[model samples]
Target: MVGAPVPALRGKPITHRIPSYKLYFEYCPHGDLHDVIKAQVDEREVPVPRVRSPGGHMRVQKVRRADGRLVPRTNRTSNVPFHEGFVWRMFEALAKCAVAMERANVLHGDLCPTNILLGEHDPDRFAIWPTPKLSDFGSSRVIDAMVASRFTPPETMQMNFVPPELGVMRGDWEVDGLKVSHRTNVWQIGLVITCMMRLEFYLPETDWRTGPSSIHPNDELHFHDPNQRELHPHSFQHANCNYSPNLLALVRQCMRYDPARRPSPRALLQRIQARIPGSCGGMDTYTGDRNGSIPWNKTEKLRGLKKDNEWPLGDDAEVVDVF
Candidate 1:
């Protein structure tokens, strides 16, 4: 799958008159990372599902939705099919985007697989194939708001992209004195990378019972060399480093046991660049890559997308125009 035309709209002022006159924003067309994930999403949730949590608050891709009577229906919704490769592309894209936010002094505060979009795409019309657009801005609390919220959120509140150090505590802890900082963003990025590496387990939610969700980040039993090196490595046992060692080393850096050791966003961008030397635009970017082997030409034909049999997932998802 290729890129969807990045969705956005120019700002417009709306005049509203009530007690007096005030300005309002019209239907802004900017798309969030969450919307992008649901559009060409391959996974669907079941009301009786056992493991996975309910989806992100945004709409999810649809299919033969279930009801009491386990029967089939002919009608379907706007959700489009997606390829698994699109998921990796989504992460790569999000990484690139995170760079943009870093330049603007804004950390996503919530960077997960859901925050990354995975829209169905066509090659003939790269722009026309309903693409997944990254979304969600509600959890964004600036560095200042974080200062006030640091004093334990009220009973009803929950935090995102926030670390344990930033919350109110029962005792005088040295770490708690520290505030949420940009490095925390890198740690969140590590979570996204881990999820991507373990996509087979997380995407469909079919294996929820024995799924990755069952494994907690701090569970050492699961990390024992013999028990499972397949899921993640035992680097967590290493002094000063608690991340998997087998995967890409930089990602481990993102999950440094010490926040002070994490690389800055600028350094992260440089690392990403060093990996994919000239990876933007066209199939030229992926000749010998894993994404280069999909059989896309069999069915995809977006307006101007490059022709290449590189998309991994077949048309199992429906690309949609739904918000």
Candidate 2:
């Protein structure tokens, strides 16, 4: 399977006497997938008339209400859903990443929109950004089917992004017989895509009454209902944004509550490749050069970069000439 590129470590780690370490990574200018998904749901405020204030500064026009209270005029806005093609591209990119992880026998416990970062857009590769790197490996671990059956994810995991199997567990927080495998990654990839399609954060079913209550101490955590139809992509699909049946079916397959029923990462990648038109050549192909070609560098025409040493770091740190 053609594995997606991950963010490269720019330099070796910098160790300090205080037992702290610093690492530099490739800069992703467009931010993460969460930012992109948020942009879709976020309303772009319409420009409103401004009035000169007593201080001679332009300010939003205010109107007096019936109660004699002045309020700024509310700006009109509209939700713009992501394009169907863009969603498909994002799905394909993430699917490739899943395949890579599966091959390495690693399980990214936290696979969410925030963890999937976006690099600069490269038109020569894809209509949208060519590279969407899977990042933040702090929660990742080597996969072990036996250990996973008895494993219970920590409460810190992003509750909304976890698969139904992981989200809806026994009151004791035990996974029971459920195995966390590549299917888990598939579920998260589907969820991220679903969020992109719906243009909002996907909130799974939760019972607030039973959660962290004096009466139900065991039910302190939120549990999703696996049987809910809302878990399916079709339920949240927008009529205005008509995605292909194949894409929807693939996403649905990934979100299957039964981990054993979901497609493997390689299988998922193959399915995604089938939907994409033309020969699967270049970076998308499994046989393609993994490192020789630099697609992210193609962004030179798209934007200018700050001189290497001039790049900003935290107040406590300064740039070092590692080269």
Candidate 3:
């Protein structure tokens, strides 16, 4: 199989006497998947009114003429869901990456929205805008079933995106001989896609602890239990969007409770390809620059890092348009 189509390293690693190393990679101008999902969610919850300008360009409507008087403006929430085509394209791209990693015998212990970067939009080279590329290999490891059976998730790992098996383990590796495999990656990809579908950072009905913690410690286990229908994805209602049954079924298959039941990365890729109108034959080539200007401003970065309460909704939050 071809090598994983991850971000190309821009330069050689820099070594220091302090035993630290620095590596550079291609810059993704569109930020990460988290930013895209958050932008879509924000647009749905609080839409920005736009008007056609004299030049035939759509611009944000800052003011309106009412009864011969200028009014500040008005805004309303929208129920538009994310485009199904875009979701399919993203799923296909990430599936190719997952397949490559599996062929190379590598497991990305942490595969979440934040870890996936976006390349610039190239209409000529790619069918979809903003290609998704897997990034941040700090938590990746070579696959070894025997060794992985004794491994446990790190404290910094995002609990929400973790597989149900790892969540139940809870630092107890000796109790169960669960080997972290490609199925683990399947679960992560499913969770990420689910978040994109619901247009929320975390799953619906997630009980975030009242304290500083953003997620309840036992949330994953609770969702895994058959009796907890409220926290399960099957019970959660999707937005009024045209999501196909085939796509939804594929997601459910990937997130099955039994790891043995989940499809391999290659099989998942084939399923995603079948959904696309004209399969590109394989993964689409990303033509975006390896070193490009960073698109995010100060406010966007802050929003990505901190929770809603931590960052106040000031003028900056209101004025900034979703990317």
Candidate 4:
């Protein structure tokens, strides 16, 4: 994997409209960030995925010169096939990120593939991909809304990564406080893992009737009660797939109908670490460093980012308009 320098990182302050809370957040760096970009983004109460609130603004190298400037520029992940081992690594990184956010009383409500970025990427081939960094905190919440209906309903929820229980909430049932919780995050994580493991498990937007993706709506309409096992769809049809029994079981537990049954982030991390030895290692290990390497925090000095001065946008870095 080719290493690239992420010079700085920044977070902008944002205000929550519904609950009215001010938040300043940080991004999990996939590679070493030389300087912590201290620049504050423009203050706006508007809502937009990936760009809103404390998630901040970043100036990325729009293109790279492997040899010359003629080559096309590249970035990020989605619909990308991942090996089981690579997926496990990604899971570990995400679990660490999730634990950090939870400690700060934050919930990454949207944990879909679209929101995940591969730290180091090779557009040509996806062999042995880099550590995954969770991004797009637009839907994140300070308070746990899993059980409560503070957010919108599941049918109206357009994202593909939401847990089954979330997909079925409706009407007064939608307003119930117990609808979502930490377990909801657990379920979303499980779904992402499942998708990463078996791309076949990913539902084609056109053909939603088949496979595990279909289980949610089917379960919602026919198997409302968990006890009613007859019409309820089973998630584990992947016996033919290569995943070990232990990993498969973990995914099932996360996607459980009862949010109470899901594992806490700490517990989930332990489970993942147990399955994969030294899963939660430092930056060097994450960047595929085999030798025993010190943690990034101990060695790397963090420099504060100045909003205007630190990183002037490069000529090649054109801002893409976001709707």
Give TM per candidate: 0.47, 0.67, 0.68, 0.53
Q: Model 1, 82-171: lDDT tens per residue?
A: 332333344345555556566555645555545444344434322223344444544655555553335535211122232333322233
Candidate that would win on TM-score = 3
At residue 268, candidate 4 shows an lDDT of 90
Best-to-worst ranking by TM-score: 3, 2, 4, 1
State candidate 1's TM-score.
Answer: 0.47
Give the alpha-carbon lDDT of every model.
0.41, 0.62, 0.61, 0.48
Which stretches of candidate 3 lie above 4 Å from their native place? 1-4, 13-15, 43-75, 122-126, 151-156, 168-170, 173-177, 204-237, 278-323
Stretches > 4 Å off in candidate 4: 1-81, 121-128, 144-159, 168-179, 204-240, 278-313, 319-323
Error of 3 at 286 (Å): 16
Q: Which candidate comes out best when scored by lDDT?
A: 2
Worst 10 residues of 4 by lDDT: 33-42
lDDT of 2 by residue, 208-284 (tens): 33243342433332334333423534454655556667777888888777787789999998988777664222333
The per-prediction tally of clashing pairs is 27, 0, 0, 12
Q: What's the ranking of the predictions by lDDT, best on top?
A: 2, 3, 4, 1
Off by over 4 Å in 1: 1-11, 14-88, 118-133, 145-175, 200-213, 216-247, 277-323
Residue 17 of model 4 has an lDDT of 52
lDDT of 3 by residue, 1-323 (tens): 01235777764444556664455566566677787767655532233456799999976555657567655355554333555656776787789888988888877767888888776454543433566788887877777754367454433267566665555334443124456787878877887787777766666333231124454454433434455412355522255655777777788788776678888999999888776664332224333244432223211121232232443345654444221
